[model samples]
Target chain A: MTHSDPLTIAGKTFTSRLMLGTGKYHDFTVMRAALEASGTQIVTVAIRRVELKAPGHDGLLDALNLERYQLLPNTAGCRTAEEAVRVAKLARAATGVNWLKLEVIPDPKYLLPDPIGTLKAAEILVGEGFTVLPYIQPDAVLARALERVGCATVMPLASPIGSGRGLRTSELIRTVLDGAAVPVVVDAGLGVPSDAAQALELGADAALVNTAIAEARDPAAMAHAFALGVQAGRLSYLAGRMAERESASPSSPVAGVVRLPDPEIPA
Target chain B: MQVNGQPHPFTPGLTLHALLRELAIAPERVAIAVGDDFYPGGQAPDCELAEEDVVEIVRAIGGG
Candidate 1:
């Protein structure tokens, strides 16, 4: 099935609805192959301890050709709004890309985003002409507030980052999709292909998978599976689903149900 | 003081963390790769700097 309306974020059109992260792959070669197999147009990269000016490190950056996939640099390790803003600016300058994935996690254990810090940083980044895509909790009100701040997209976590718990916030996720004016990209904690499919089926504009695909027995194959799952989910959502009923009832009467024993008759 | 394989002036008596703070660098943003080992941000305070030591303080930048 062909995708009629490709997903677009921050004026960039992506044929693939799945946004894959570049970390946790066994090797760069495997990562390259997985990215190709996944057909991911955008890949996320964390900004943490890299000597960009060093000559030898150029090979790592060179391996990722900007033409094939757009580089989305994230402020992954930031703890506060000030730190996030600073990192976002530095990332924009270093990568020459305006797109940023704002991730401000105060808690190292869970890596859960600090909503207040994320919003504060996002507001500043958006005003600074950066295309901010905040990794936020599945809070409908927070999603709306982020949209109001001119965020390019709102990436709500399906669960804690790297926990692989799957969609623990399905209800809140649905609420976000129903209310969000901007794209809702389900990011993080997607353990497998089915998790990604579930997110897509729930009307998420895109799903970001990193550890699940990278840590698989075969990263490339897993990437392909995720790609298919995302596509299936998107198609399912587009096709729409029948409303579910609380109690089970036959849509058509059974042929043998015509005669019933009298109520007073003993079995 | 030695940083990234270059000798630089340092206060006669200052902790590695103090030197970093004097440079207006956030400890969290910098990772110290000393000798053949990598020390996390928190370890900087106790790890005193020695002359001609290969103190590689790598900062986080944008890249995959």
Candidate 2:
């Protein structure tokens, strides 16, 4: 892609369109290597209470190079707008970064985003000057509403979080893409590199991958594969594809007519 | 005082520095929220904790 084609979100430009989540990794070493292999400029982390009984265990800051990645803190465990706002504030205070990934999943079983709660939280966070990237179900109307409320990006899930189900909501996601004024990031449940590629091919600005890479036997290798897949899909989209038709067309010239004698042996 | 939603032993003039030290928590590794006020780790040394304060000490964890 050209310099002018970089993924721009909230007035900030990112060279790499792949975003990563720092979760479900075997260890920090693997996570670090995977992050490097993936070539992601934005990485997501969650804000959590320091367990009094378990101090020094949560060391995300120590493991990750802060300068290398733009940390997009997510409100993962929050079930309401108030809780998300609290988490957002805590995240901003800790990292001094205003960019947030707002997720309000009230349902524990399905883990689907609560659109009403998400919208409410987005409005509040955006008003507070946080560049919000909200995780949501694939709904075109909600995406437009979020854009109207000054969200930096809208992240629609392909399937349930960590399910590795790979674009179960493609039609809905396409609708969101068609209507989105801001960047559209297909997040969650991307099973493989092709899944990510398909999202990019379908005109999504980016894809956020976590489980598929992290849970793989070779996370770093899988990450590299995903990076290449994303680039390939993006290039294919730019190159454009041929139109499909019901009947097949001849590749060779049909004007050349050759008459061959019937074989006696075949008869 | 409630710290992280649990009642902890309260001291009259406990600074965040002393509390963190007592808890064996590194000040630079966490962010402190006392009621509605947010205090970064750098400000912990000067900020004192009140007896009836509700504090929340948080840090970054692995998540998507």
Candidate 3:
């Protein structure tokens, strides 16, 4: 927590450890406020093609202040590698940030990122000079595979996307963390501030949160709480925790017990 | 004509700019694509569209 340097990923440096998601808020005003309160440097935005609003009417981009936060465009709706790459290119063309969150989820029920498709898209994105951070299941093999293919970081999901279930895949996520050389960003399914704190305490490089804060009654306050949680967790990680054992240690010396007279004997 | 996965009336001489105007989209707000080809925000005016082309109007939305 005392660290003052930027977080480096794939040769790029960012000042914020908490990456905010600009989704599920009631409106842009609250979203922007929450973003400011969180003090996030990176904001993840999805690529969407919807029915156009009236001309001169601004969308989320207008609400976003790029000077305050860097926009990280994600291939959120893409179900294949081709789709993800296409979205990635479109995002770069639009926002001009080379950093992307490569998400290719063909399965909608669980919203799990497709392993093969993610790996494929990561290769293409890396070759295209994009800093790729792939959202994936907490599969150790897939995490390593993504790292080998030149992804800046591997973001393993805590639970299903938007489930707010919180770290359903703890063991596997730990498995991935154990062997990860690059940063392991715990992404998705984080429901509370403690979830993020726990992730950092487990030695994750960071956590990307959205639904928890955005869906809260007071998003701005929740955002601040999460920022505090991240700080606490990171500090705890740096501070280190005590080891565990099967039995308890002596609280007082056995030899230090004082002798006393029996009241019934009336000594 | 399909716009945003919905069928619309097809009209000849429909340039990308006119389509945006018809849909009331501020050209600067979104990035355009016809099938797999992406055009810069400014290119929408010159880029002509063909019938049956799946035009994608991509805007930034909230994500995590």
Candidate 4:
């Protein structure tokens, strides 16, 4: 029941199993505080073009204490393998870090990943010495394929990104957990603390949460709750669980009890 | 030259570093790429900006 071991992805050990997505916060200061409360060691940032400088406004990097967390640069808008590769390289160049969350979302309506492009990009990035963690659909065969392509981790979505739909693909997620050799991270659509806990209970190595925490009234408190939920769920998973039964069974032993309940039983 | 979808007047021998300075952007906070070719680390400062180049400047933005 004790969750003592740290989570290691791409040979890097992390004390927290929860990875936060830095997005959709009303204030950056609040986001920073929420991140600290979540106790997450890694956070993902979407790559985009922007004029980040303004009077009295420091950059997101400066605002966020980079010392406390690892920056997971994501190729969010990339729709092709080539584009993802280019973005990954640019992210590495800009951040000076090889860790990347490779996302190839060809479909804009739902923000679902393009598996073909993802697999292609993962192969190239892994060959190029980058620690690639791909965001994919909840497909076990695809997770295995990605791991075969040498990805550092396989992140399968529970539902559409930011839908807050929780785990719609529970069986599929279990499929990946059962077979995939690499660590399976349940990413996206985790609505609340219980959703995150359920994913951990389903045997996921970690969960990547965003909109739910960021959109909450009190992001810091919500993040803290999620951290505790993750730990509790992971402990429950580690401690083992009873097997499922087709029918109800009595908890107390009936053999040693007196057999004087005939009136109530017949009635 | 086009920077982040805006057409900026191309200067003679403008480097990526110069463009970042022109935008008043901190270079440490962004990633720059001219088409498919990404300028990695210190090399971004050396890549010369041409008029036809569409410089895509990327930063760490909020997202899930």
Write out fnat for all predictions, comma-separated: 0.18, 0.73, 0.74, 0.71
lDDT: worst 10-residue window of model 2 chain A: A256-265
Per-model TM-score versus the true fold: 0.77, 0.94, 0.90, 0.90
Model 4 clashing-pair count: 0
Please, what are the lDDT tens digits per residue for candidate 3 over residues A141-236? 998888888998999999998888987888888899997989888999999889999988888888899999999999999999998887777788
DockQ of each: 0.11, 0.77, 0.60, 0.58
Chain B TM-score for all candidates, comma-separated: 0.69, 0.84, 0.82, 0.80
Candidate 4 residue pairs in backbone clash: none
How many backbone clashes are present in model 2? 0
Tell me the tens digit of each residue's lDDT in model 1 across A193-255.
Answer: 999999999999999989888888999999999999999999999999889999998879777
Error of 4 at A157 (Å): 0.6
The parts of candidate 3 lying over 4 Å away from their true place are: A52-58, A250-267, B7-12, B43-45
Question: What is the Cα root-mean-square deviation between model 3 and the actual structure?
Answer: 2.7
> Is 1 or 4 the stronger prediction by DockQ?
4
TM-score of 1: 0.77
| lDDT score at residue A23, model 1, on the 0-100 scale | 82
Q: Distance (Å) between predicted and true CA of A123, model 1?
A: 1.0
Recovered native contacts, candidate 2: 0.73
Count of clashes, each model: 1, 0, 1, 0
TM-score of chain A of each: 0.91, 0.94, 0.92, 0.91
